[model samples]
Target: MGSPGRSHRRLPQAPDRKTSIQEAALLPISRRQALALGGAALLAGSAGDARAASPQGQLTWAVHVSLAPTWFDPAETPGMITPFMLLYALHDAMVKPMPGQTAAPCLADAWKMAPDGLSYEFTVRKDVTFHNGEPVTAEDVKFSFERYRGTSASVMKERVAAVETPDARTVRFVLKKPWPDFLTFYSSATGAGWIVPKKYIQQVGEEGFKKAPIGAGPYKFVSFTPGVELVFEAFEGYWRKLPSVKRLVLKVIPEESTRLAALKRGEVDIAYSIRGELAEELQRTPGFTLKPVVIQGTFWLYFPEQWDPKSPWHDLRVREAAALAMDYKSINEALTLGYSRVANSIIPDSFEFFWKPPPAVYDPRQAKALLAAAGFRNGFDAGDYYCDASYANLAEAVLNNLQEVGIRVKLRPLERAAFFSAYAEKKLKNIIQAASGAFGNAATRLDAFVMKGGTYAYGHYDDLEALFAEQAVELDQKKRTELLHKIQRLVHERVIYAPIWQLAFINGQGKRVRESALGLIEGHAYSAPYEDVTINTG
Candidate 1:
């Protein structure tokens, strides 16, 4: 598969498979296509193989962002991958993207889609048990799916006709129509398929369950202090294998300086999102390793006010000015030391049916001319620009460029959680620097960020919406690709978003950490497959 950052290159697709849902006939475990669909898990060793060391010591992490309680609950996952950082540690999904495969079988050892594509079946693993000693049955899978109230929950529920549990191990989902993205959406793209204890949730209630969550993952929840830290202990009964480390601790360190300070003091084994000079320092320091993980998150400047006829952004020239004003190359070099790939489209090149737009031309004179033509000869106040506080530097950089082109705006940095909440509710106006790191291809990206009623979309174009609808049910692979490509091209031509770049998340680890698990999973910014992470006991 080609990197999504690579322009004009067609991403490789799995052999003998079509992107259309109507033609997608998935088989059970052991088949090549089934294996392809179920991305291969990042297993440390074969379950039967003897390990050299028993689980020991504690592995602590200094995370770059605040740990939101919403992340602990798979039921409320947004249309992003942030929650999965915690979910991978505390819970197990039916099928999930692991190191190499996009939809690896986890709890459900095998899954198959019916020939007609109206139904899908999953064969639950018989050996798995929740942290509470209760068996993970097919009922749990059905319960979890039905209870999901996450980002894409409504669309999923509307399409699914019924969920059936024929036995303790077999769970079937009958859809109202043939949805080609069933596996992609349910398994990897959304948390709809991440299983939870059926009886436990009912017994404890939603609030209580969140207070003390339990799952069939490698780690069992020990404690959680809001805005501080989350602690977990190894779950011996975890079906995959015993975790390498006995204890895991995730500490929230919102400040980059403080995170690096913690890492320098050996207070944390791993630190995430270290960038710029701090990254250079980490690379220079002995006994420390700095890694740059190229993630799928492509940042972009969104003009929510563009849809409003009364706003200056309603004029195409003004939008184009904003796009042309950005100095992408300099921004990349300054922030990531040129590690981040300058993005040309909202859709990453790695995605299926991706359409690469022409390279972004940064011409301040052209931008000024466009703004002047839009009747803003002396510049205009563009209201508040909302962004995650963690990336305030990025927002400032973008603001500086826009200001140079007469599009003045004030920076409004919110905490990561609040920023997302505000964006989703459409409370913030003007420019929004947004990014989506969720799994899936071009179609999923379009559905979430471009289509009408998308979780993050404030408005939609009628023609684009129609094209999206037309492609949703199109069974022909070539036709689907063409339709998707057209939608992307239209978005680019209209200057809906000023595409930034695919992020190169610079992270670091100490000598005590044997396997940080960083960069092991492609497109995942954080260290993952918690059970595979190990620390030196000696």
Candidate 2:
């Protein structure tokens, strides 16, 4: 009946023995249990919260983590912070952003397109070297892509045919079609993470590659303690100058309170992703550092096309009604600690050309009316899949709001891994929410969200699939802009998915920790370049 807050625990689970990426309860629980798992938010409704430093030479960096990385292979999982580290360090790409936010220049020094717009050529930097000290050749670029083609995770394979290395320093990508953001999607901040050392990767299988990734990054692997720690020392021979900080250490601590407590006690250098409730407390405890960079990202809603027929959401009206009935204003204010702004498109406003925010019209009566029109005047029951404790709090508020609208909705809270898998398989009830994008440009953001094989978006919608393909390689600005707008509108009309907000987390950085491997970028996590980062023990 009332909103509540929880602490240090997952929301209660259903008695049934069922688990999936996004697990549903064998049966929904009473309201009281929901609050417990959301911590403060589940209990009340709103909630809370990387990497190591360099080791080589003289500096040692220490970064605190709240959880073990879900995965370490960037080529495979974009969501894993461990793999993100590899993306910048061991591999090089066609394009990367110049540090201090200048032009794009990561791996490829320069590139050009054919007159027909179908083929794009990138010239690799002459001096770059991989972690194993192999001269980066054009074939390695081709190898990286050839590997990408075998998987469903990447969209690049569909449009690109092959890589041709005319010489040691030149790698040219021949695209099946001309794409405006194709270069950016793969090389820019939005696309291809660095290439892995090919021969070594083949030598060691997927599992070995994850453990000891040898990248040309500023830092190199030192030691890993599984769920507890992973350390890397500086690579002075990095293409860039020696990093100011040296060794970087990643410390894993899954509980939020323990992490915040570690920061206050000066035991951990950073409580990386801060939970919302402990934020005020952490800030109150002096010597804590706050770096509030505007992240280019958004929270995404996942609406499955088909749900169980007997569920309340079996009707489209119920689905649309829940969307309209959700009160984001209250949830944002109460749950996010006022750190985020409402997002319009999957792209963050930080981008150069984010589309205009669509008119936000919130009407619970209309939501109910829609349900009534769809034949549920008396209301029905369903579930909301919460990916985390913090979101569970926000979801509970949404569930609370839906209750007000006469729709009896239950909050189904899950651990992050299972939650993601459930949504990916489209097995959850027709709706769920997740953080989405912050690509540097309109093209990159839209492609990541609507692109055929994007991590966040479901690729089933044919019109969306067609629009994304055309928008990517389309050379004309006028036509590209029009297509982007059409795609956004089309997604809105379908109402299967929508944008919530671009968010920044309140983080706890240690007083003793100095920067080594912690390179901040557009979004959260270790997805940015890890060079020039150093950790100091002195």
- Residue 515's C-alpha lDDT in candidate 1? 92
Candidate 2 lDDT by residue in tens digits, 386-477: 55444565566666777877777556776555665565555666457565432346655555455556554554568777886777666566
How does model 2 fare in lDDT? Answer: 0.55
State which candidate has the highest TM-score: 1
Q: Given candidate 1, what's the lDDT at residue 29?
A: 23
Tens-digit per-residue lDDT, 290-329, candidate 1 = 8888888889999998899999989999999999999999
Query: What's the TM-score of every candidate structure?
Result: 0.92, 0.78
lDDT of 1 at 408: 92
Off by over 4 Å in 2: 1-70, 79-86, 89-92, 98-103, 149-154, 189-193, 306-316, 359-362, 384-391, 406-418, 438-462, 513-520, 523-528, 534-538
Backbone clash total, candidate 1: 7
Q: Give the Å error, residue 123, model 2.
A: 2.8
Which candidate achieves the best lDDT against the true structure? 1
